[model samples]
Target: MVFQFDDLKKKTILLFISAPLVGAGIGFSFMFFAIKNQPTLGETPWRTYLNIGASDESMLQKAIRTRVGIYALPKEEVIYFMASTDSDGELLTSDQRYEVSGIAPATKIWSITLYDKDFFLSDNALNRHHFNASSLNVEQGKPFSFVVSSTPEVGNWLPAPQKGNFALCYRFYLPPASAFPINESSLPKIKKL
Candidate 1:
């Protein structure tokens, strides 16, 4: 039998329609396996806690090797630095406490937030998940400290959970380049509490 143009057109149309479905199926299968087999943060050096022989100079290298993304700050940028469970070398308990601290440039608004290993803010009844420098308690010209404990403290207390380990993520937005450069050296050092 001779092949007809109509048959060819129909087959082409069918392939076009079916290709995406097959591709999607394969993509989802791959993603499922990837997620299932993902290595725990502890299994890799990059994922290991920070502050292990870490200083301001070497901190950026640690972040890069671990794929911890940091953006360059803007000129006249104000930086908020803090330490938390995400800071370094400390295993956090759901019931344990932690804190992040840093000096803000005498100019901009700055805040710190705590996130679980999943990178989402903890859901709590109080709705108090972040601490801003302006709103935090500062005793002297030094960096302000926020307390992390299972029990709430008087100032900037972030409640810890009772179930799993957690990582505290800090964000320094709107930083000026005058003091804190746009380079990696400008990123704040996060010390694990």
Candidate 2:
């Protein structure tokens, strides 16, 4: 024998079956996109994922690598921080211009790379995505500065997409032990200008 429900009952059953699915979908999407977490090793807007490239990498870091496709080295060799906000804890949006200034970390090599909300190199007319110690203008005992904006700037312009959010990745290669405890002052300051 086959059992059939009335129109109202059918609709109610459909809602019951789909509601949790919809809720779970929303939760999963948020997890995939933002992957929110408290700062583990740095102040506002800067965070270091511990145990990266090791056998016991944290679950959060694993998910981040999967989402961003980041290829990280061992912790001793590479200490990297990814910042999605500014010094004032404001989300880094492309619509606004920003000044990124800081003293370079003493390491074998280092770079500050910018990625769009989707964790990919933002496509812009300038075709610039990252600035390394070698590429940036580094003078003896002087701080470096750059402008991050969609429009062209006078010097050291890192083109940002016109809309949506962005993130900055600061990676130091073969860094010294002192660099492990990254001084907040040493990290590049992201100030909306």
Candidate 3:
């Protein structure tokens, strides 16, 4: 059977009108699931919220560069706060997780954790992997770099979800910022590598 031009036009209009209703139905379904299921960090991933650009390359390098008063925080003081950072376009596989490593000369304590899109600690078996500054076996002489990956070789690592995006949040307390440039250099730097 063949449809005439006028019949086709009517069909097209009907499809257009029905399309929005279909989409609304799907949207409502998602909202219901979101309310009922309540996704977790690894369960839904968090990389979707990140935005990176090469235009800011120089600016980022500048942020990483050493500057005056960069490490001015008091070493004897304990500052408690959770700071979040993002990775470029580096996608993590299901087998991968997160690992953060850094050195503190005189800091009494420090930790890095992963959170879901909702800004809550990831709901995982390990209860959100976190390693204190003293608990880490970081190298000496220079600031340490931690690898937040799904499948890290060894050292401090945070397990991620099976297949979804995620984020990192670092908390420093009584950090040796005066001696180290963590404040100036930004402890966690996102990478696509």
| Number of backbone collisions per candidate | 12, 0, 14
Q: Which model scores highest in lDDT?
A: 2
Model 1, 42-114: lDDT tens digits are 4211121223233453633443424432443422342323233343545666655555455553434556666
TM-score list, all predictions: 0.48, 0.76, 0.42
**Overall local distance difference test of candidate 1:** 0.52
Q: Model 2: how far is 85 from its true place, Å? A: 0.9
RMSD of each: 9.7, 4.5, 13.5
Q: How many Å off is the CA of 44 in candidate 1?
A: 18
| Model 3 segments more than 4 A misplaced | 1-102, 139-142, 151-153, 175-182
For all candidates in order, the CA lDDT equals 0.52, 0.79, 0.46
Question: Per lDDT, what order, best first?
Answer: 2, 1, 3
Off by over 4 Å in 2: 1-34, 40-42, 58-61, 139-141
**Residue-by-residue lDDT tens digits, candidate 2, 9-104:** 989999999999999888677666565654634555787765667787666568766665467677787877888898888898988998988887
Cand. 1 TM to true fold = 0.48
Residue 152 alpha-carbon offset, candidate 2, angstroms: 0.7
